[model samples]
Target: MDLSIRVIRSDEWEKARELRLAALRDPVAHLAFLDTYEAAVVRPDSFWQERTEGGSEDGPGTVRQFVAEAPDGRWLGTASVLVERAGAESFFADVPEGEQTHVVGVFVREEARGSGAIDALFEAAVEWSWSLAEPRVERVRLFVHAENARAQAVYRRLGFAPTGVRVALHGSEDAHEVEYEVLRPAA
Candidate 1:
């Protein structure tokens, strides 16, 4: 149950790839993520290297990935934040009213569920978002499949509230993903 949260390192591409593949294989991945294990597994090593570098602490500040590492060196969970500026084309929904951070690629190993690793990962991700220098994030948001009650409940417990904006899930016209957000704490 002992774990520490930290931003990934550029050299830890292999570990990042392994954890991401495992996440893609999780039961809820279909509802929680846009990429599939099959698709990700075929990506070249260079792709993973670049991805790791882009999300690493030394990488550009537009995105960051945080991992919860167990005492034994195993990654228990991860969450990433993408800075979204107003007027920029969003990958998921309409343009935002102001700078915000979108939480994505959330995952925790089954054995680590309810072990506090997920919470730790989220705290790091949200904290990093709020600490951005240039475009201070006004809020941290995430999209959860409408039917993913479990994830929705967990997010709500973590202080994210529905923002009244719903976007149809990509590739599924009928299904939707509800947007939830936690505004930055008052200064």
Candidate 2:
């Protein structure tokens, strides 16, 4: 349960890439993610390089990716949060002009599941989201597949409540992703 949680570094792009590919190959990948291993693998190295660097601590202030590194240095899980701009719009919902972090791309190795890695990753992500300055983060949100009960339970336990806003799934408008959020208390 003593996992090392921290932001990934740009130099560790290869490791990050490997873990992501592994995640995409999981049985639930279709329901859990928008992209597939085949598509990700076909992308040029420069894409991975830029993606890794963008999620690194040295990257822009709006995006962050965290990884759970086992004691032996292997990555056991990963989570990413993207800060949304209300004026610019977001991939799934409206940002409302205040700072908000959209959590996504969550994954944990099968062997690492049920060991608090998911909780640890969420803690890191929520902590980082609230730590931002400037506009200041007002809330953290994420979308979960309607059928992903496991993920929904975890999010509820972490204090994210359903926002009553749902988005249609990519290429499948009839199916929807449920939106949830944890609002930061007003001062």
Candidate 3:
């Protein structure tokens, strides 16, 4: 498909913002993401600039965003990883047994689905997490809404298994997000 997967650069904030907005407008966005298009679109440019800068390749090691870009320079998909250390406060789920990376903001354009763009994006994200030095990450994890079967299947295909740990979804008292993990391979 002539696509390349790479970490985002701080200078590409505008492109990142555009792709994110497009992701938020997808039909399954409500099920796939925590933020709404209305809220995201209303955010000032500076917010996107800061967000991109923080998650860029040269930014802090705590988080990283990967994107699949076509030869034409359009982003086909994206995935982000958040580093979590045991005993530290986590913004998503509880701290894990050891240092880990939390995968989030997973999205692929409808036309790009089944084209392997999502897979490539995830591979880059996971590889980057495992490459961290000193206090290396022990695993990578993500939470999917219980009803999102499509996403669950894809994550399973990528080797993530349910950890049997469920947490209530934000803003919803009755629904839950199921945790999944891919343990680091033995050397």
Question: How many pairs of residues collide in each model?
Answer: 0, 0, 0
Whole-model lDDT values for every prediction: 0.91, 0.89, 0.90
TM-score quality measure for candidate 2 = 0.96
Q: For residues 51-132, what per-residue lDDT tens digits would candidate 3 score against the true structure?
A: 9998898998788999999999999999999988887877666695689889999999888999999889889988988999
Best model per lDDT:
1
14-54 per-residue lDDT for model 2 (tens digits)? 99899999999999888789899999998888888899999
Query: Tell me, what's the RMSD of every candidate?
Result: 1.0, 1.2, 1.0
TM-score of model number 3: 0.97
Look at candidate 3 and tell me the lDDT of residue 178: 89
C-alpha lDDT of candidate 3 relative to the true structure? 0.90
**Candidate 1: tens digits of C-alpha lDDT, residues 1-187:** 8999999999999999999999999988888888999999999999999999999999997889999999999998999889899888887786578789999989999999999988888889888888888798899999999988999999998999998888887668888999999998888
Worst 10 residues of 3 by lDDT: 88-97
Winner by lDDT between candidate 3 and candidate 1 = 1
Model 3: residues with Cα > 4 Å off, grouped in runs: none
Q: Tell me how far candidate 1 lies from the true structure as C-alpha RMSD in angstroms.
A: 1.0
